[model samples]
Target: MKILTTPDIPIATLFQNMREVYATCNVDVSWASEEVLNLPALNIVDVGTCILGSTTAEQNQLFTHRNSAGSNDIVIYFVEATDPPFNGCASHPLGMPGAVVVRTATQWTFAHEQGHVLGLNHVNDNDRLMTGNGTANITNPPPDLVASECNTMQASPITVNV
Candidate 1:
């Protein structure tokens, strides 16, 4: 994790929530390391609505800070904010598995964006983790991840057996 800005919710709280969510699906997730960045120029990134098909120069620059991360490792960048209407983004430069999260994100936002990094797409269900409407709209507490989504996540190169 690379924190460009402090999030409204504590990172520990968010990670706890994520661990609980993924635990239900038998996928153990944990952060290997963290760093606090002082790049004021890249703090507030313009993601242009976070379309998964492309990336912005600002995002490209921001993501370059991944230090010594293996190709299969996923780097999570916590920024002050994305353009607007997006709390987090899963799009990355080709072959780089990464995601950018905003300071205002909900507890589940980190998990949702990481889900995308693991090849999961948005689903219409509000009770699920992959909801297209946003994490705030999730109707269920500790949003559910169905079997198929679990398979996709586990199959990703970023996932490894213990």
Candidate 2:
């Protein structure tokens, strides 16, 4: 469970929040750039400039990034506000085990996507972080998200491949 954050306009607090969550999972995360390669067994998180609507070019870039991994790799893209109103989505290379795209909204978006990165899916549990519609119940979450997810992950003790 390694996360590589790309340079984006998100607030430092947001990144801090993400770091705190990953730390609990023992997930290793680092800041990387688009030019980076050789990241075989890691999760790549990128921040893309606002590109409204779903177009071929946008889809292509996303597909390229999502498919860059060999067998066990993941990519997450963070895009700014969009028009039609989409909170977030998970996409795969062809259509399975893909990257997650989160629409920057409140504080919980990062963690929600990180949930996907950790191989966790959305949960109906209102207090869980994977709750949709921003009801993630994690406002200013504790220092460790895995510990937070313990109730959900059944104390699986995830190790973030940072």
lDDT of each: 0.88, 0.45
Work out how many backbone clashes candidate 1 has: 0
What TM-score would you give candidate 2 relative to the actual structure?
A: 0.52
- Which candidate has the highest TM-score of all? 1
lDDT of 1 at 27: 93
RMSD to native for every prediction?
1.2, 8.3
User: Distance from true position, residue 122, model 2, in Å?
Assistant: 1.3
Q: For every model shown, what is its TM-score relative to the native structure?
A: 0.95, 0.52
What lDDT score goes with residue 103 in model 1?
Answer: 92
In model 1, how large is the Cα lDDT of residue 117? 93
